[model samples]
Target: MQETIKKIFTENIQVQIAAGEVLPSALESAAFTIAQSLINGNKLLCCGTPSCHMLAQHMAGLLINFYETERPCLPAVALAQEQVNLGAIANNDEHETFARQIRAFAQQGDLLLAIAVNGNEKQIISAVEAALTRDMKVIVLVGDDGGELVGLLGPNDVEIRVPSKRPSRIVESHLVNLHCLSELIDLTLFPQEEN
Candidate 1:
C-alpha cells in the first residue's frame, strides 16, 4: 500500500512537471480573459462531463464565493449545476444540453470555461460552437492532444492541453491549474490584498 501511494505521487509529479512546461502561458491567458470579463461586468459560465463537471463547479464556486482572500464575489455560473435545465435539455436534445444552456446564459464578452479529459465529446464541441455564436471568449482545459476540441477553437479562444493521455493525470493537473487560475484571478482583481 505504501509503495502504491509513493508510485501514484511519483507519476502525478511527473505529469504535473510536464504540464508546468506547456500550460503556464495558456493558464495566464485564461486568467487574463477571466479577469477582463469580470472587470467588464461579464459573468463566467462553466461546463463539462461528470468528472470534469465537478471541476467546473469547483471553479465557479471559487469565483462566485472566494478563493483564499476576503474579496467581492465574482459572477460565475456552472451550467452543469442547473439540474432542471440539464434534464429538460437532455429530454429533448441530449447533445445540445450544454449548447442550449450556453445560449441562454452567456452574453457577449462573457467567458466560458470548458473542462474535458478526452476533449472529443460531442456536447463539448457543441458548447464551444454555442459560445462562439454568442461572441463569448472560451478557455478549454483538455487532455490527450486536445482531441477534436483543438480543431474547433477560434483564434481568440485558448486551449490548455494537458500533456498526458491518462485520465487520472489529466484530472490532477487540471485541479492544480484550476487553483492556479483562481489565485491569479483573485490577485489580478485585488492586487492590493496581502498575499
Candidate 2:
C-alpha cells in the first residue's frame, strides 16, 4: 500500500513536470486573456464536466473572492455550481445546460473558461460553440491531445493541454495551473509594489 501511494506521488510529479515544460506559454496567455476581459468590464463564465465541475467553480471563486491576496471582487460566474433547474433549459442535454446559460449571460469581449477531463466532452464542446456564437473568447484546460476540442479554438483563444494521459494526473495538473493563472492575473491586474 505504501509503495502504491509513493508510486502515485511519483507519477503525479512526473506528469506535472512534463506539463510544466510545454504549458507555461498557454497558461500565461490564458491569464492575460482573462485579465484583459476583466479590464474591459466583461465577466468570466465557467463550465465543465462532472469531473471538472469543482475546478470550474474553483477558478470562479479565485477570481470573485481572491486568489491569494485580498483584492476587490472580480466578475466571474460558475454556471453549474448550483444550477438545480438546469434541466429545464438543458432538456437533458449536457452542453445545453451550459450553452443556454452562456447565451443568456455572455457578451462580446467576455470570456468563457472551460475545463475538461478529456477533450471529447460533448458538453464542453457545445458550450465552447455557444460562447463563440456570443463572441466570447475561450480558454480550455484539456488533457491528452485535446481530442475534438483541438479544432474548436479560435485565433484569440488559448488551450492549456496537460501532457499526461492519466485522468488523475491531468486533474492535479489542472488545479495547479489554475493557481498559477490566478497569480498571474493578480499580478497583471493589481501589481504589487516591489520593496
Candidate 3:
C-alpha cells in the first residue's frame, strides 16, 4: 500500500507538471477574459460538484481579491458574489438542475468555468453545450482526455485535462491547478497600477 501510494504520488506530480505546461498561457488567457468581462460588467458563473465547489469558492476569492506584490496592491473590479449570482445560479439538484442553472446564468460576454473529471456527467456537458449555444465563453477543467467533452467544449474553451490514473491524485492535481489559476487571476484583477 505504501509503495502504491508513493507510485500514485509520483504519477500525480508528472501529470500535474504536464498539465501545468499549458497553464501559464491558459491562466493568462483566463485572467484576461475574466478581467475583460468584469470591465464590461458581465457576470461570472463557477460551478462543480461538492468537492469542486470548494475549488470554485477558492478560485472566486482569488479572482475577487488582490495578491500581495512587491509594488503595491489594488482593489478588485469584478462583481460581488451576489452580483455574479444575479444571472448566475448553482445547480445542486441531482437531476438537470446543474445544466439548467448554468444555462440560465450564462449571458453574452459572460464566462462559465465548469469543473468535472472524465466529463461523463451529462448535466455538465449539457450545460457547456447550452452555454456555447448562447455564445457564452465556457472553460472546462476536465480530468481525462475529454473525448466527447473536447468536441462540445470546443477549441475556444480552455480544457485543463489531467492524466487518467489514481482518481484521487487527479483530484489533488486539479485542486493545485485551480489554485494557480486563482492566484494568477487575483494578481491580474488587482494589478498594482490601481494602488
Using lDDT as the measure, the top candidate is: 2
- Candidate 3: 10-residue stretch with minimal lDDT: 74-83
How many Å off is the CA of 118 in candidate 3?
A: 0.7
Residue 65 in model 3: lDDT:
53
Error of 2 at 5 (Å): 0.6
Candidate 2 regions off by >4 Å? 81-83, 87-89
Residue-level lDDT for 66 in candidate 3? 36
The residue-by-residue lDDT of candidate 2 on 1-84, one tens digit each, is 999999999999999889889999999899999999999999999887889989999999999999889999999999874456
Please give the range of 10 consecutive residues that has the lowest summed lDDT in model 2.
81-90
Lowest lDDT block of 10, candidate 1:
80-89
Q: How do the residues 121-174 of candidate 3 rate in per-residue lDDT, one tens digit apiece?
A: 675676677778778887777776665777886666777777665557657877
Local distance difference test, per candidate? 0.89, 0.90, 0.64
Candidate 3 segments whose C-alpha is farther than 4 A from its true place:
64-93, 193-195
lDDT of 1 by residue, 1-195 (tens): 999999999999999999889889999999998999899999999998767889999999999899888899899999863447465547776768789888877889988899999888888888999999998889999999888888988888999999999999999899999999999998898997355
On TM-score, the leading prediction is 2
Decreasing lDDT order of the candidates: 2, 1, 3
